[model samples]
Target: MQKQAKYIFLITFLIAGLVSQAQVKQDTLKREVEVTKAYTPTISDANKLNSMPEIDEEEADKPTFNYNIKSQPVFSTFSVTPLKAATIETTPPIQKGYGLVRAGLGTYYKPYGEIFFNNLNSKNTVFGIHAMHLSSFGDVKLKGGDKVDAPFMNNEVELFLKHTIQQSILSVDLTLNHDAFNYYGYPEDPVPAPLLEDEQSINYFGTKQAFTKGGVHIDLDDPGAEMDEEEFGFQLDYYYFGTKTEQRENFANLTFNMRRPLTSGVGLLDAGVEFAQVSNITLPADTAIGKTSSTILFAKPAWYIGDEKANVTLGLNAWFILQTDEETQAKLAPRINANWAPVEEILKIYAGIDGAFQHNHYSKIAYENPFVKPDHHLKNSMQQFRLYGGFDGKMSKRTTYKISGEYAINTDKPLYFMNENYYFDAAYNPAPLIVDNTFDVMYDDMNRLKLNAEILYASSKKMDLSLSVNYYSYKMDKQEEAWNLPTWDATLALGYKVTEQLSVSADIYLIGDRKALIIEESGSLIPEDLPIRKSFTLDPAFDLNLKGNYQLTNKFSVFAQLNNFGFQQYERWFGYPVQSFNALAGISYAF
Candidate 1:
């Protein structure tokens, strides 16, 4: 009964809520709108415009490119400079000139001149001529305040010709030389005048030809044998002395050489022969100073073993010496030479052993020392052995070095000595007169040792340097010392290009101590000893030379030379002092 009542109450409540939520209704509210009447008007809405702005077409699209920029060096900024067209440089091309003439004057009344003509017949044949002259006429003051003039003059001329025929070459040379010198060794007031008849002249003529197998058109009968190349030459030398002293010499030589490859082709055979004749003639012949002649026949046969880069030659020199009233002498000397290239074209070593006979004559001696006595007895020098070794190598592309050493033994070697001949006239002269202010030859056995070194450096930028040194040791059998021979010598040369038209060079020369013999004067009278016994030593010497050249035009140039800048009064000879600081300037013209 209770449950039925609860359901009835729930049903009654639901019906009551439903009836209350669904029976309510509301009324609607309305608003009114007002309308206006349409009106028409006349047309006018456009406004006046100001003047149009002007347009700039040129500045419309401006470019941002740059035309001027600072130049930058391509190689290096701080060290290297950029190559560019120079504003102050206006150098012209240097044309080739064939002929040249040079002339100059310097202190001590010295004059120098040279002439060259090399443009003659420039076709297949070439011919040239050269001539030179130098003279000095001033007086030199001695240490004792005595002034004396030792005038000297030299003249030389040369003619050269070259012709090429097919594959062969032919050349000819002709030369003539003359010299004049005076022996003014004493004071001006007390010394007797010397004879001015001392003059020397020389003439030489030579012709040579180089012939190959093909050029000579040689036909071989045997196909296996090869025809050799040959060289032929002829030379004639004549020398004469014109003065109170009469001396003349004539030398003729004929040279022939032939070389051929061996059958194996690994070696070559070389053969050569030289025939020479020497004649000495003197006018008003005295037994002690008469005409004398000699003949020499030399034959050398060698074999070359190795390739072109490295080779060893084994040979012998056979000489036949024939002299007047003397037994014939036959000399046999061995000749050997070896060369090897440890590095091709870069380093090379060479060694050789050779011997020869040197002829001594009046003309040869006078040519070396014009003060030599004209009346000289000629003799021959025999070189028994000479051994030498050297090595040359390139340190860099522009630098090279060479060092060499040598040992030699000689017999009958000629040494220079001051003459002891003098005359004194008590009536005409106050001082003694030296008949000959010259050097005489003395024969002795000698041994020598030598060492030499050289270095050369050259750059592509117009600069070069060369240095050399030589050391020598000599021992004599009969003499106290090797007269006038230096123990050490050195030289340095440097060249630099200042500009396209200018160049300069510097040279340095050094000489070590040398020994010499001088005749002693005992109270204004020369001694009557058979030979001079007094001797002295010469101190070391140093010399500096500077030279420069400036080219004004292609065919004209100016040059200058400065010598002995150190101002050292060094004696080159026993009594003759070298020139002091001197300068020479000259002009050269070429056409």
Candidate 2:
């Protein structure tokens, strides 16, 4: 009963509180709520980890590497063992000498001498002096069996000095020459009363002709120079010529050469200028014939193509002349050339068209033909043109050959003819001696053709042989024949070395003669109409010569020469025959 009474009271109180809360919820009111702290949830780990295991690459597997070694250049002193050691040999140097002297005498009363003095093995300067003398005291028989003293004396002296300035060279040369000859030529057969035994001797009436010449040359060669520039070189030449008579001449010349390179030395531009002046033409005899001087200006400009194996040049050569004796003239010619070598050092072929001019100075005429008289101012010859082709080279190790042909046309070609003159000097006691014994020069136009062949054989065994032959054809314009010019010529030379100090040589010459003229005065001493010039053939000339040399010591040697073995009295010029079977012996010494 007491619990029931407590519950009933509690129930009554709860019911009353619930009724009040319901009334508060049904009423509208404003309320605010605030929180000051943040809440974080926490997790606690167990003993086991959550990650899975991975393979241990360092413990179970290893990496593989591949590499290679390369070779390189290394310098070191390393030697191999030789099987047998011997001495190393070297080649010996050649010996050089300073001075040389040679003297000889021939059976025809001929004496020859030569001497040379020079410096040896000089580094800066080279100097030399050379002197030569050749003289003959002999007589030559005329075509009519008449004898006359045909003596000749030749003397020459040369001095040269060469100095090196850097890569270029400077050279100075001086030359002196003197020659004397006697006029001994006579007409063929028909006897002249003036030269007969009854009359005075002709030798006493005649005088020896003496000619003297002096010359000097100066040159400076410098290959390194600029292109398009004028003065690349300095060259000078001068000469003075005098004769026994009143005739004299002076000549001087200057030359300049220029070059320009294109295409590295394969192609080049070349040019040259030459001014040659011949003056002082004097001599009372030739004065009235117009003693005029010759002045010439020559120029050549060419283009060079190709290289050492094959080459060609194309250009022109021109000339301007001022001749006081004739009209002034200008000339031109093609200077075209071609060369090819099909096999190097084996065969070479060449072809060219060229031209040239030669002065007919007394100095040259006397050298070629000593019988010339100095009473004229002759004209210079002009080579209009020339066409030539040839092939030359070694055929085998011991043999070489050359074959060539040439065709040329020239104007004012000098022809030698027999002098035909009549002079009577009663005041000098003259009975009209045979004065037509000399030679005179004449000018003419002519055409010439030539074919030549040559063979040379040589070996290291010290044996050599040379054979050559030439044939010529000529057609004269104003003259009947090519006077005294040969139509064919041949030569054979052989040499052998029997031992180290002994050697022998042999030579043979064959020459075909041309036309010659013989003039004779038949009737009057001085006639109005002169005899006509006629042409007659001379006999062929031949000569055979042998020579020997023995080297006795280091600086001494002996030589002997035998000429004209057949004693053949061959006639090389009109009314002049060579010595028969001459012999010469000499000794040479080098100091």
Candidate 3:
């Protein structure tokens, strides 16, 4: 019963404590409310803001700036010397023509005409054609009344074609030539007319004239901007010559050349082959004529060394020759050349040692001297060695100069000379008359030395001038002199622009004295005896030529040329005298 009561009391006490804690919590959580009134204020100045400001708003006060100016005296002086005037400046006229036609007539019944047409403006292909004709129908002063007319006529036609495609350039050329001349330099005969006529009939040397030549050439090359340089070329030519004495010659030549770089560096190789056949139909087939056919083959391998400032080329040129009735010959020659630029592009020194074989042909001989006798045998000339050195440099701002020297050794060098025998009517008048006009080929060993100098000056405008001089010395074995070769030669050329439409030019040529063999009659009773040969000196030659051109219109121009103004009747060959002073006036039309 006591435990029960204690529990009840404990329970009652816990309930009472809980009840008191709740009542205290309620008392402590009693809510209290505090309220405050909200105030709303109206714009009292609304009417005042709606009106404008009291200050004036239409304008503001004006602003101004002040300036101050000052002055000072200056002094200057002028020089007494005046400034030089500048040269007259003008641009050259543009030519709007693709074809040009030129025709002219001059003294000695000379007539000249030329026609040139070109379509070179095409990007891929170019074509051109040129034709020229020159003729002289003049009368020469001969000793006898043989109605000798020194007539000469030359006609030429050339066609050119070039094509470019993808790093390669190809070109082709065709040429045709016809040349005619008359033998009018025969001397008068002293014998009676009948006897002289009979002698002439026996050895009738008719007017030898006429040469016709046709040729074609083809070239294919790479200029080598991206690769090595390569080139291939070929040429074919046919020549026919006829003389009034029934002398005729036929010649044909075929030549091929190739060049290739062996490596991407400075190594190169070149090769060439030439085949030629010449026939002198006038000679009997059974006679011992030398070399109806000839063939030459050559090869060169080279190495290029050095840089832009200095360079050298070392090469070996090997060649072989094959001719009918002769043993085959082979040779090797050194080709060493060098160039040094001491002052960049302003001065250059060059030296070389070169050698080659120069083959002679009947066609070339007849071309060089039209009066060569057909009975003579032709031979080859070989240049065994040559040493040359030169230097070229700029002298001033507008002037340049060059000096060169050379020494060469040649074997079997050919020279032209008159035959020692003369035909005459010995039964009648014994005096020799009507000398032979035919030349013979003489071969000898020759040594040549030469020195050359040149200077050129070009002004800023209006004028240009150039002068060149060459001196030569020769020593020959088994020959009296080097026939027909000049020892000294000089040339002077001047160009002046007087006005825009008019221009003038002058050219002068000076040639030194030359030696020739003169035949004099020795007291001999036999008609076949050889004549006495004496050395004769020919006078020096001086030639001056003047030319002027006036452009009357864009398509038409007039030109005048005065040739040999000094009126010197010089003999270019042994017996051929060139004409004196001559003039030609012509008009050119372009389209």
Q: How many clashes in each structure?
A: 1, 0, 0
Candidate 2 ranges beyond 4 A from true positions: 1-94, 190-193, 196-206, 222-234, 263-290, 421-435, 519-530
Give the lDDT of residue 75 in candidate 1.
Answer: 10
Cα deviation of 160, candidate 1, in Å: 1.3
What lDDT score is found at residue 376 in candidate 2?
45
lDDT score, candidate 3: 0.59
lDDT of 3 by residue, 87-116 (tens): 211225344446667787877788878776
Ranking by TM-score: 3, 2, 1
How far in Å is the alpha carbon of 400 misplaced in model 1? 1.2
Q: lDDT winner between 1 and 3, please give it.
A: 3
Candidates in order, TM-scores: namely 0.71, 0.75, 0.76
Kindly give the stretch of ten consecutive residues in candidate 3 with the minimal lDDT sum. Answer: 67-76
**Each prediction's Cα lDDT score?**
0.53, 0.60, 0.59
Identify the leading candidate in terms of TM-score.
3
| RMSD (Cα, Å) of model 3 | 38.6
Candidate 2 C-alpha lDDT tens digits along 376-443: 44667898999999998877765677899999999988877774444455644554535455566777
Top candidate (lDDT)? 2
